[model samples]
Target chain A: MTAGGHTLQLFEQRFGALRRARRTESIMLFVILVLLFAVSAVWTDFSPTQILAGLPRIGEYFEKLFSIQPGRDTPPVAVLSWAHVLGGIKEPQSIAYWFYRLDVYAALLWQTVQMAILATVLGYSTAFALSFSAARTLTANRTVVFLTRRLLEVLRTIPQVVLAFIFVWPFGIGPLAGILAIAIHTTGALGKLFSELNENADLRPVEGIKSAGGSWLAQMRYGVVPQMLPGFLSYGLLRFEINVRSSTIIGFVGAGGVGQELKRVIGFNIYEEVSAICILILLIVIAIDLLSARLRHRLIGAL
Target chain B: MSASVTRHLPKIPLERRTLHWGIGAGAFAYFVYLLWLFDFDRIFTGLPKLWVIVRLMIDWTLFAEWDHAELIHSMAETVAMAFLGTFLATVLALPLGFMGARNIVPSPVFRFMTRRLFDGCRGLDQFIWALVFVRAVGLGPIAGILAIMVAETGILAKLFAEAIENIDTKQVDGIRSTGAGRLAELRFGVVPQILPVMISQALYSIESNSREATILGLVGAGGIGLRLSERIQINAWDQVAYVIVLILITVAAIDSLSKWLRLRLIGGPAARG
Candidate 1:
């Protein structure tokens, strides 16, 4: 029998071919990687000694949590009483010292969720409309398609946080600014998604509709939208998950979410409670991501 | 068929006309109300003075008296931080992404768990991660880099997994039928196809993280943003403008370079589309 007939031999050969990295290329890759590491080390102020030294500060910060004191007498000001502080409330000073203000966090979370939902829905629908024109097969207006695509790119190029700050001046420090920020981003993102979907859509139905004398809107309605809906819904679901996390950050600029609270905690050096909030946010994000994934899968499967 | 039978065909419901009119109307109303509240007069009144602010901004960033050298150093630090963070995230994400991919693993349970783990890693904002790292490691660019790396890993991993899953399975299958092991199949069949996408994504992530790294510095992570916040607190609108301009130019340059590189790597239409 030929040597190639052995299964183990074939596997070894395949693996060998895949693993055959040229010495020069491998060296270059290693050099680049090392350089990146070196740059990170240089830019960061973290030294081993500093981390060790900061441990006491972290301890002292925790110690001050159980008692109220002036900034100089201890570390930072201690805001929390003993009970809640002992119960592992991170940043007891930020939460309890301000008058049992978990309510604010709850309220902000609600606002963030509301804004995310509203914006995602709005953005997805607008994308659905604009994508028809943008798709090469769906529309003949080259100028309109090019302009709209460019508009979306410009919109997306501006960071969402920057957009939030810009809108804050106009819309005031409320969920309105945050919602607008997210909506605009969603429009850009979803528009791109929808256009791609439209471009890849089966052409037979569109041709049939056109040949049968359907108008532009009619052709879209009868042929394109149906085919594009599944992809659009999937993209929208994904965006919704992202918006929830981003909405919190937008809160830092007075858009009203958990991020505002986060800023306050950090400014006051409320470390433990900061940890708590981080944990909470992480849980929420994970839950939403999982849920969105499942929902998207089910949605597409149903279609 | 008989004429009577043809005439008696059942009537179907007209295609349901449930357009999203309510959402459209609500959004339009909100836009109008917001526009009115912004008070255009206030903005217009401030516009002419913007030139003076812009001048001040330039001086603060490029020609500041107190710490001109320091500001330049900080700007470099910010770029370095973004580069490190994005590179680390990309490297860490690639393996996890392969595991998380549906088509790659073919084990539903394993994929689900890995996917959730990725979500957990990426779910928190980089700022929050920065806060966490600062406390753990103390405030510095290290904290910033670590924060961005952990935060971005989740997103990059998800995107990478999606790219992998979307790849044509036939090539991988062909490699396997040649008695190739899974790793071999991935290296030869999967890696080549997705490498360009991964590179483009890595560049985009670097661009995005640069913006984010600036914000992380606001909380004392380290970068130009730390100085920017300082100026803002002192109501240095001109300085703020200067810093903004610096950031803008840097970001624009990176964006253009990334686009050019992407086009070069992939044929133009394919790269862009």
Candidate 2:
């Protein structure tokens, strides 16, 4: 065979073989994934039959959650205007009408945000202190490192809700219990993140400080903390975002906040009140997210 | 001499550090005040009870005769709930991700609306979603899964869309040069570019959802949570401790596994952590 022809033929053969191999690999992967999902579905009792039966109930629930609408049989207003679109504040169909308890909602929202702020501030500070030892490159005493890390892990592993549940016993059912619960959980979480940042820190400064006979505290304050502060603060901010959401949930178990109120409204089947409280909570969370994002950007820029 | 002095004298002099120290001191004082106001007396009185609770939680001897099979089952259920919810979230998010991507959808209105919808979904905390789902589905892992699925979908879509928008559009142009249809171009180009990110995001979601799901049981949405709550309520400290142990192990294992996979697939260690 001509050399050109032989090279072309070889290229085709190799390309075909590669394509076939890829196809088989993908097919096998697909099969395995399908099998896994199937088994998981069965275990979770998420069968199609169950979903179909449950879906309408979900629709009904949402129907109640949505602000009251004009009855299907109600006659159309003769005129359309912006004012008409906004159901009257006292009108049952208006969103504002549903949330008429705005003062109560606002107070609860403020309390919830306070809980998150306090918890995050306290937690991140503790995390900042603990992270030095938690960093593998920094700690001189292995025992201290081991103990600190284990402590953080245990703090993180237990749910904040559970901790709050326990704390309620000592502090009584109030924001204090909620704050402590979230703070402990935050310490574990932020410590891990902070330590990772510490681990990744530029060590030259630390080594420089050490060679000059710097004290352990001096090494951290001058050498490690500066490099990691921005990252730590960023993570702390993110944790605050998460804690804000969690503090809302912890309230349901009598830890105190808007969530306690939310739990009450939900239990009584007062769907409109639930919707109002929910809307308020949603707005607070979004505001926090936007504010935090802006703050992080500015902080990083400054650093 | 300057460098030596720098090392000898900490970077910030004591006088200069006063402001920083003051902030810290103020925070500490505020915390103490809060604690004091919150019935600090109760804590001192409660210390004895706290020790008993801690001892109960730490003592494995009490867990020896606990129902091992049930504990194992609930642990499995927790993992399964995380897995199932994450899977559904990823599946539900993928299409919306495409719609939300500004590069993909040229219409600003559509893109804006899609993003707003995502923000709205994430704004409501997952606990509320769980409560809503429990009401809807009548209490089970299915409700937990659905709640997680709904709650995560918007956030995942937002992440996925951002990843899509950042990809090198040159690849899509290269695929287009071959006379491929839009769908084919996207299939051959966009999907591959986004696959690594999508997988990592999904895996990360499952890890986080696992933590969140552990508590969904508190809302009766299904997981080991209901059992945990039950144990806590009934003062079955041993069982509660055992369940807590199981959760810690599972969470740590999954976390390491996901990190490893992300590192392997993405070709980088967690340097940014």
Candidate 3:
């Protein structure tokens, strides 16, 4: 009992000291966080005073994102006025009012979505063709894999907009430029991901196919492709979503999409229309994300 | 031979198989139509221009006469903008994340509202926010920083909320049993579980925001993109190539550095090795 009491006392003493030390560490961490914030605030010119002064202006800017109801007395930010918030298309408060040029915006939206889809399609096919050669377990030549990987790395690092700029010179300011640029970027991005997926794939089937005297093509078709298809498709879908956003922004550079329209209006100081298009984009993007996420979960979960 | 054929055959239902093929064919047909609509005639005629661009990019003489110091300044600004933006966003998101987290707030309505707010912020493209900030904050890297901050706050809040919601209830129960108040409970029970995830996500945002800040600069929000855009506006292909080279190097370097740091933060292979 005496020995037990002695050990318990020692344990208490050690833990008490440790706890104090941990408290000190947390205090230090907090202080360091504060210091980092202070330094970054200075470096980035993030003035709290300016931000506070700018708040009303910022709010005014966002307020412009909304259209006033034809005769509503309440502020746009007022609570629970669903009618004003969701006013009918003809109503000034409605989304349609801000997005008055629905047909034009819709066409641009479709063009942008198509750009993304086509780019992803092109990118995924190329990535699929190259991934087998890139994967270490499947590749016969190490040098080929290394070269392919490096090429993919270089491909992905350059901004897609820059690529769009390059291609615009060739393709002359259309969806073609946007499509080709995004496709080049997707190739690099998707190709890297594809190879990584391929590397992690089960090799048992590949070995089995080889032992059965299967051709190289047959081995990949029967073995690796089946195992990696779900992941590849999921990645492709994610890339498509990203490419849609990229296509929209690339249009700001005169590549193609509703983004060009956005730039046009913004250039003219048509803030309401810009927000309208931005809202439309937000709605579309969210819907696509939620839908794709559902599909992705179901598909990947089944695996 | 018949038995082997039966075993080798795919087991997909006939309707599903037909549906799949039909969808594929329809998609392909539409894609072709879209491509045809896009005027591919320029591709053939513009081959010379493409060659010209290739030659321009290869000409190393562009860098010989340009202002190297200004280029370096812009590059530094880009990195700083990313770091500051990500930091500020994460700071804002900490409380917002708690408010939005179902497990933390325990009120579905409040959590739902907070999450919806975040969604609105995230749903808009990054450039759109940059455009808005350029208007609000005036044209500069400050606008770019704010844009990054606001956009990333939306993203980080959702991620942090999810991380918080995923924490083991048993852990929190231990702290609550001690009669600890809300802040204490959070410090003791909540923060530890999600700290690593938050750090990792913030670090990742830093890398992503660097890419984004470059583009934001194009809209006059300020960064190396400003330089690139100015050059592009003038059709200065050689200077454009020089900017591209700098961007590529910076991106590659940051990627490797961040990868190393991320692994270390997570105590992964780099940390062990």
What is the per-residue lDDT of model 2 for residues B1-273, given as tens digits with 9 covering 90 to 100?
778866886477677699889999997897777566555567676678767887877877755677788767877888888888889899999999999998899999999999999987788877789998887778899988888998899889999999999989999999999999989977887988898889889989989999989989999998899989988888777677788888889999999988986786566542211
Candidate 2 wrong stretches, greater than 4 Å: A62-85, B1-42, B62-64, B260-273
The TM-score measured for candidate 1 stands at 0.66
Count of clashes in candidate 3: 0
User: Which candidate number maximizes DockQ?
Assistant: 2
* Predicted candidate 3 versus true structure: per-residue lDDT over A232-280, tens digit per residue: 9899889888887788788977789878898888778676687778888
DockQ of 3: 0.57
- Clashing pairs for model 2 are none
* Candidate 1, residue A130: how far the Cα is off, in Å: 3.0
Give the C-alpha lDDT of model 2: 0.84
Could you give the fnat of all candidates in order? 0.39, 0.66, 0.59
- Give residue A19's lDDT in candidate 1 (0 to 100): 54
TM-score of chain A of each: 0.77, 0.89, 0.84
Off by over 4 Å in 1: A1-21, A36-102, A270-272, B1-76, B89-119, B134-140, B153-208, B224-273
The RMSD of every model to the true structure, in order and in angstroms, is: 8.3, 4.5, 4.1
Model 2 Cα shift for residue A192 (angstroms): 1.2
- Model 3 per-residue lDDT tens digits across residues B1-273: 669989998899989999999999998899788778776566788788899888877787756788888887888788888888898899999999999988878888888899999998887777888887777778887888888888899999999999998998887899999999989889889988888888789888999888777778888888898888888777788878788888888877787887887786567532210
